[model samples]
Target chain A: MTFLSASLEQSPSTAEEEAYLYLQRGLRLCRYKPGDRLIPEEIAAEIGMSRMPVREAFRRLAAEGLVTLRPNRGCIVAGLTLDEIYETFEIRSVLEGLAVRLAVPKMDADAFLDLERLLDRMERAGQTGSSDWVVRHQEFHALIYTLSGRPNLIRKINALHVVIEPYMRFWFDYVDKPLSAREEHERLIRAFAQGDALHADQIMQEHILGTAPLLAEFASPVRR
Target chain B: MTFLSASLEQSPSTAEEEAYLYLQRGLRLCRYKPGDRLIPEEIAAEIGMSRMPVREAFRRLAAEGLVTLRPNRGCIVAGLTLDEIYETFEIRSVLEGLAVRLAVPKMDADAFLDLERLLDRMERAGQTGSSDWVVRHQEFHALIYTLSGRPNLIRKINALHVVIEPYMRFWFDYVDKPLSAREEHERLIRAFAQGDALHADQIMQEHILGTAPLLAEFASPVRR
Candidate 1:
């Protein structure tokens, strides 16, 4: 029931929770693209549940900004405007900046190993042009933020990532791979190793801000 | 309904919206203090409605971290551990720091005048030991952050403020007035006026962090 991240590791305890997770994963992975309508009955039949849990899931997703609930119409996948996409990146910059600043002091050898593993996975995904690259990209940042030990801050930052992930997926799918992204993250890891919180904070903010304009420009042509 | 802030300016469009706002205001203002059980029937009676809307409100408030929804026990006002209080302040420090950093460039003669007016009202509320002081204090900060022109970021920051305001009210109610709060804010305004975003950011973060230990200490004895 925790909306902190998109992790599917935990099993759902309730039908509504199950429905929510199913729909959320679908939305996050761009299975339900922006402007797609979600019919409660259709989703309920698909999930083999009554319509009520699906309706409740819609409300929860609406609260999370993952979907829009219309008065008479059904739920629609929430799309960010070009401006909204940039605004989200700006917000994520400051929040994830705070994350790495706090995280650097707490990063131990184990955390560094986990970071390296995720980096390796991302590089592999990038070479294969696998969609898993976007997910690994997210996990790499999530791993760093989780070390901050501030659950509330990490939760808020992860929610932003959830809202913006589809757009990121869209950018990666249609546009060319970011050639500098790996280099930037490598520099970021080096900065983290230095244990300079402020320096790491700057690097993290710039790392997030670095992707904003590229996504904005790519998303501009396709408003949906 | 907008979960932006505790603004009662707009009329509610639905029964659920009405109940949500009422409960939100009560929780934020400490009318229903931490750990208080909110019975749907009682609140529905007070609002002249059925229990359905009140229950819906409980779900929304639960999503907001203002209340805990036990499976069989209904809703209870959420109580924070001492660690949570400190953690929230740290989160607010960075978010509000970003706020002022963005807000400085947007400040103008009119905005300065508005800030002075709110400060005046806050001073009067403090002198009278009026409960309105907590509200005015929120307004002062909200005024600055609103100038950020980033609605999503502002919305997220305001949600954190909503979660922390009751504790602030508890501190001010039980402990002495912050004698230096006004002076600290004055210094913040001066920093903002200088248009040095980094300095203003630092001041804002420190100003928020400055209050954390004091509130934590005061709330420690009464972990209700």
Candidate 2:
């Protein structure tokens, strides 16, 4: 197989590519369900565009491991078993633990300030049980990547978010008694301010894995 | 914006996607320098294809963080600073260390035997200093992931592999030194066989981080 050319300059531009991103977003949002046979023509007709763009979108998703590309088999949404979900958490536990540790030392005044702002927002959102908290809360932690000074580490952690996202939101939205995510975030910020790496790490670990216990068997594939 | 999606199933089989994969592979091999601006049409022509697939390829690379998207501004192959590289290794060190720790106790005779077989292959490949040995060496360690019992952890590590591939391959190919890798792998395998998790973990931690000293300068945009 050919290696990555690394020539960022040679890539072409096209409407198909833009169309792919649109479809990718749609698919990721479950507008396209697993095992759903996607005819490029159908999508194009729906979007009132040509089939070309939709096809590019599918190719991109396939590359991201979100869709399967069977030569003759067409495509399907990538599915994860219970075991796979638990294993993802197992890995997330370690990666997030490391991320928190790195984030602690680099938790500067600005980082803490932003984090405080976010934590406050999360507290308010949590009281109302709004999805906005969930979104901002992700950004709040992503800020830690800037603090941790580790793009590589952050990248790994970010990918974990992609895999677990479906379950995370579901648990928060559908579970009978969702977590007090605000409390967890609040505890984490306090840990960060204290500059306690181990404590912060532990709290983040619990904060993340703590969600596993509440995931419903059928609704969420992830296991504890 | 997507919580977690498994939708959409349209793929435009364009030459651009193929070009993207080809270009992506080249980047992994360091074929293109950082900050290179790719002309989509030119690349499409050169590859005997249309601009569509090449555009899709660029989109995917940008998503992977290998290249940055400038909107209409164009693309730049990402360059990892020394700090970024270190962070990558540091987190990888711990995560892989955790993987080894989790894997060590789980290895039975059959697994040890397979690992030993892989180790022997590495030694031979090291002696000859062949590129294939280096590739297989990765596979050898991949075998250990089975012991990891966590597919998500394995995938995360593999993702790191994709990110660091260019730098690692460039360094080793240029350095003409693969002996250190040989020694470290040997020690690590021995620790596993001896059922010493701490010892194995320590050896791994050192071995993983040890690459920094050899490859740090190469990781940057300016070669030292």
Over the stretch B1-224, how does candidate 2's per-residue lDDT look in tens digits?
A: 00011111233354654686567666776777677777788788988988776776776777666777676777678767777778778877877887888899899999898888877777766543467676666667777765878766665566566777778766766776745777788888889878999788778879889888677875554331
iRMSD computed for candidate 2: 4.3
Superposed Cα deviation of residue A132, candidate 1 (Å): 5.0
On the 0 to 100 scale, the lDDT of residue A50 in model 1 is 96
Candidate whose TM-score is highest: 1
DockQ (C-alpha based) per candidate is 0.54, 0.33
> In model 1, which regions exceed 4 Å deviation?
A1-6, A35-37, A70-74, A120-129, A132-135, A221-224, B1-6, B31-48, B70-74, B120-135, B221-224
Writing each residue's lDDT as its tens digit, candidate 1 over A8-40 gives 557887787789889988987778878889998
Residue A208, candidate 2: alpha-carbon lDDT: 67
Least accurate 10 contiguous residues by lDDT in model 2 chain A: A1-10
